[model samples]
Target: MSADTLITLDTPTDGTTVSGSFDAKGTANSPEANVPWRILDAGGQKVLHGHFTAEGWMDKLYPYAGTVDVSKLAPGSYTFEVSVDDPSGGEGKAPQKVDRSITVQ
Candidate 1:
């Protein structure tokens, strides 16, 4: 039950100038068969959300990579919450989360 998944968002600028992507790496983790992720602003607003399939179980591993767009968002701090969904397994054992604050200004 060791799924070490990593989600990263990169914004090199401020306001509408900032834009980047989200990435995941499941190889080193417990190999998540299926998982969902969501991006939120500082005010707990939903910005973006997505899910992944465990198609490449053997070769790909768990930590997969994804992308997002944050340029249109206003200048302020934000947060991200990634939820795990493994129908084959139970709850709490599959989900993983990571949080960070960023300023668009």
Candidate 2:
């Protein structure tokens, strides 16, 4: 995963509820399908990170989704990213990153 991925953050009216989804496209007729994601703050700190594995319907769906808790976070900006990775030196591909700046008040 590169450092240029984009993660978009959606802020609701409640200011404490935050949720969104991401999609990592799969290859054509390929059995490999998975996307790793990470949520981080402005200080390069990791808030949450995980991998999602789901089958697609003939390259019709990318299948990536997650929900984050903003109640524990202070009023500030943050970043989220998703990437396709393999442990066998194939994880250097460009990952999707989304950065969002939010204020509590």
Q: Judged by TM-score, which candidate is best?
A: 1
Please identify model 1 stretches exceeding 4 Å from their true place.
1-18, 22-32, 54-61, 86-96, 103-105
Worst window of 10 by summed lDDT in candidate 2: 22-31
Candidates in order, TM-scores: namely: 0.51, 0.47
- For model 2, give the RMSD to the true fold: 7.3
RMSD of each: 5.7, 7.3
Candidate 2 structure quality by residue, lDDT tens digits, 1-105: 333322222332222324343233322111255556566777878876775554542344344444444455665655655454444565555444333443332
Number of clashing pairs per prediction, in order: 12, 6
Q: For residue 63, give model 1's deviation from the true position in Å.
A: 2.4
Q: What is the lDDT of candidate 1?
A: 0.49
Residue-pair clash count for candidate 2:
6
Candidate 2, superposed: residue stretches over 4 Å from native: 1-31, 57-61, 89-105
User: Could you give candidate 1's per-residue lDDT for residues 21-98 as a string of tens digits?
Assistant: 434433222245544666687768888777655444534344445555566767666665454454555754544554
Report, for every candidate in turn, its global Cα lDDT versus the true structure. Answer: 0.49, 0.45
